[model samples]
Target: MTGRSDEYPAAPKAARRNRGFEAASRLLRERIRTAGESRGFAVSRLLTHWPEVVGEEIARMSRPVKVGYGRNGFGATLTLLVEGAAAPIVDMSREQIRAKVNACYGYNAISRVVLTQTAATGFEDGQAVFLHSPKPKPAPSPEVQAAARATAEGCADDTLRQALERLAENVLARSAARAAQKKG
Candidate 1:
């Protein structure tokens, strides 16, 4: 045969019709493993399964930066990069997070969890998805605005009156839109 035969002794041409890919996620795992090794990330799928390990809420507020080991074979410390003003929130769930991480590794891999406050840019290289609130809709019509103003005319506190007016306007505009939609 023209081809070298050391590896496979030239598998019959028909025997190698096609070799399609394995799962894409499995393929990506090799890159992930290499990244973990190079970047000192926890090799226990912490970054991949973050949402499952921690609930969605906490996952958005925090992410595991790295697992730092103690000398003399002691337990390791998990540094979590928490975003913005959610430091207290992450601090409150420290033990719970440690327990969950240990369970994931099937061992006491983490002795303590450290919360490090970070900017949103902390996850710049990641594909993490966070829950976002829907944008508030603009008021639909001038009639709703007028009705809201009329209803708020007698209020003593200006701020309270303005808030109440806005609330009324939004509610009235929504109902009016729904009614028009039914007719149309």
Candidate 2:
């Protein structure tokens, strides 16, 4: 047999192109990682908006009923409860949604999404799903403060400082409620 050359075998043109694509993908991934870390975003926080993150995937399978915050903060994992035509379709849809969510988070935050069929309505209207941003933290008000303080001090269990703190929180909540009612 002829002696082999030290040089490697020549890669096909397609293989060379694939390598280039891989390199580009790697660079893009590194940039995203660096940016995410620098933005002070914890991995947990990023996982929150799994739905929005995987929007493209969700669109492919099931229509997004509600794309908003879940239990977490704003733009967190989207609560995507879908009602598709058939069970098999719905199952595949859920998987697609899951993939999209994972892709969106840039990690596997969502293991599986809860899926359900829409209740039959006479007109075939879509399911009633509510999507909303996280409720803003109500600010402390003067009255809440006073009440909290009274509750803390008079209660005997809490210290004076604790009472004041409680009062502050109570007052703030009351004020917020009032403002919300007025808006409504």
The candidate that wins on lDDT is 1
Task: List where candidate 2 sits over 4 angstroms from the true fold.
Answer: 1-61, 65-79, 84-87, 119-184
Model 1 residue 148 distance off true place after TM-score fit, in angstroms: 53
Candidate 1 global CA lDDT score: 0.82
lDDT agreement with native, every candidate: 0.82, 0.54
Indicate the worst ten consecutive residues by lDDT in candidate 1: 121-130
**TM-scores of the candidates in the order shown:** 0.55, 0.26
lDDT of 1 by residue, 126-182 (tens): 444457988988755888889999999999999999999988988888889899999
Window of ten residues with lowest summed lDDT in model 2: 39-48
